[model samples]
Target: MTTTLHCHMPLPANFRADGFLDFHRRDAQQVAERVYEQTLEKGLLWHGQPALLRIALQPQQAEASLLLDGASRRDDEALLASTVRHMLGLTQPVEAFEAVVAGHPQLGPLLARQSGLRVPQTSSGFEALAWAIIGQQISVAAAVSIRRRFIQAAGRRHSSGLYCLPDADCAAGMDEASLRAAGFTQGKAQTLLRLAAIVASGELPLAAWQFAPDAAQIGKQLAAIRGIGPWTISYALLRGFAWLDGSLHGDVAVRRNLQRLLARDDKLEAAEVEAWLAPFSPWRALVAAHLWAMQSSDGY
Candidate 1:
């Protein structure tokens, strides 16, 4: 049986399809694909069931179709559409962010060059947190390799033959030894197991964190977990919950790129990055994404 749910959502005027598509193409995880620069296909587990999503990007909106083997309830369809919007960053306030930063001496030009960029989120909070744990202290290449292995070891396969990252319930069922076998450090494996268990038991309330008005409370809860720190939490919030205010000043890429953007001879301290980003409150994460996107192409 073929089940398909078609949905569409408005996109920001400056929406750039490449920003979203290129991100998924960064690895050969076989989990998602950029069929072209403007279209994407991803397989994921939704509510413990397999679904494949295909998105077509237009200048003003995104059209998506969710494919499932079984019938979906009306609420499930609605939730799935919401997830797609979040994943594609259609929910972000890009126009407002751009308007606020239009006058900034440093960011104005960068934004002009990287216009329409929005921070994309993962399918679920657990996947974002788990990826952050797997990515700690490793180079992007190394992290990608480990992540691919981890997914193959613990994730579920859709009928389309793509593997989806394990959700909290699946991760909670995973053994530390399995993660270790997938090239995770002992500490990382333990941390992921703890996080998964916490989230699975509803002790963390991670899935609902995005809708919660109090970000500080959510931050404190994430910080209480061992091995998860400010950087991890911030990254998870940006990628998992789609909260754009978390300070990612500790990210090495952000720091390195900032120095390059400023043409500074000295390395930037975390305090310096934090202070520099202070004025961009409520959109600091978007600013960080801009910094992360800066390179030779941006004339930096």
Candidate 2:
């Protein structure tokens, strides 16, 4: 049986769905798509039943409409609503970040250009961490292609023709040969397997760590894992845990974007970038998001 539910979520003054979705559509192989003029996720579920959710937003509007295609019970509706809020970053206030940006000379113009951008969240922590592993030292296009192959090999199929990202258990159970066949390098495959094992064994406790007070401490813990360095952990915190305070100084793209934004001829070291970002403390992740958005606008 199929059911439908609708919910309205209030948005901050500067929320822009198009800018966020544009950032999301960068992954050409993403399971979600622009469907029927709305952003759609095919395999989202409510109470163990397959559900499809469409997020419809109007620029500058005060609220967004969330339409769920297979939700029945009130609990299912609540779950779906929470998921939508988190995925779209709807709960974050943004006023403080905006006030800070307005006082900056360079960032002010960038902010004006991309007024309502939000950091897009990954579907799950496992998916976020796995993508971080797969994307290390590779072009975004190549990473997306590799990720598509990996998901097809290990992920669960739904009737809607979309695949759910592999959970820790599914990824942990994948053999090395299968991962290699999915275009993973031997070293990368080994690292991924190790990470999956850690997660599946319940050692990392990623969900609980998301609510932890100290992000730097969590980054340290994740860094101790093989193949997870500062960059990977920071990216995971930003994308998976919705950590606004995380800095992406170690990210190559972020560094390049920063240099370009500042019109600097030389590359800035990670320390230099962090120093420059000191004023944006607690909202450094949003600054990184804007840097990424600037790159996207420039067609990079």
Candidate 3:
């Protein structure tokens, strides 16, 4: 069934598409039927395929539908509805709540321009670590390409364009040679393996990273890993999950966006950009999201 919902009189500022798509292995369509599985998925496959859903969530209502390869499954329909309910942040729409905190001396201007900050508690610490390793020193598109390869190799299949990101057991089972063949550089491969080992062995409490006390504490946890640096950690904190206040100054795209937003010289320091975020503490993530939205808006 194709589902749609009406707004709650006061419409939400933003909505999430592909709430489960985040779990997809950017490249699982090629290799196998049973790959890796995502957290939100009900099982490997309703009939051996990744599930695609269209969910429209507003504060008052949400609607989700999945037509599994032309056959509708009520179980899939209910699962889609339930997952969307939890992930959309419709219960609180904390974006509004965070707005109140945005004017603090720490996060004033960034919050001033930002309209929404929806938090979805999904990512595991291991996923964050692995994503951070893959994203280092690369364009978002290039990183996505690499991610597709990595995910397909380790991911379990669900439906089309969806799969689970590899887990420690899944990834660790692969030899370095296998990873290298999938385009992981030796250093990157090593880093990923180490990160997997840490998560798998219980040395790092990545599952608890999202609720970390403050930026400093979160930074400490992230940087403790070998390949994870401030930039990489901050990126994961911001996107791998929804730590809204995390800003990515080292991100070339964000840096360029800031330069454009500020109308400044190319050499504008990352510190200065971060300083500009003083007014938007905790809400900076929303600001960053808006800027990204602007860039992707109108398909520019």
The ten-residue window of minimal lDDT in model 2 covers 61-70
Separately for all candidates shown, the number of backbone clashes (residues 3 or more apart, or on different chains) is: 0, 0, 20
TM-score of 3: 0.65
**Could you tell me every candidate's TM-score relative to the true structure?**
0.93, 0.84, 0.65
Report, for every candidate in turn, its global Cα lDDT versus the true structure: 0.81, 0.71, 0.53
**CA RMSD per model (angstroms):** 2.6, 3.4, 7.6
Best by TM-score: 1
> Model 1: which ten-residue window has the lowest total lDDT?
291-300
Residue-wise lDDT of candidate 2 within 1-300, one digit each (tens)? 556666667777767766656645666656644343446454433333444556766544323333333437756566556656776776555666887788688999988777767776765566678888888888788787788788778756555666656777778989989999988999889889998898888887765554342577667778888778877877788777778877787777778899998999999998999888777888998898888777664321
Off by over 4 Å in 1: 32-34, 211-213, 296-300
lDDT of candidate 3 over 32-101, digit per residue (tens): 2122322232222233333444443334444444435345454554444444544454443465655576
What residue runs in model 3 are displaced by over 4 Å at the alpha carbon? Answer: 1-60, 63-94, 97-114, 117-123, 159-162, 208-218, 265-267, 297-300
As for lDDT, the candidate ahead, 1 or 2, is: 1
Model 1 C-alpha lDDT per residue in residues 187-207, reported as the tens digit of each score: 999999999999899898876
lDDT of model 3, residue 28: 39
Evaluate residue 239 in candidate 3 and report its C-alpha lDDT on the 0 to 100 scale.
49
lDDT value, residue 122 of candidate 2: 63
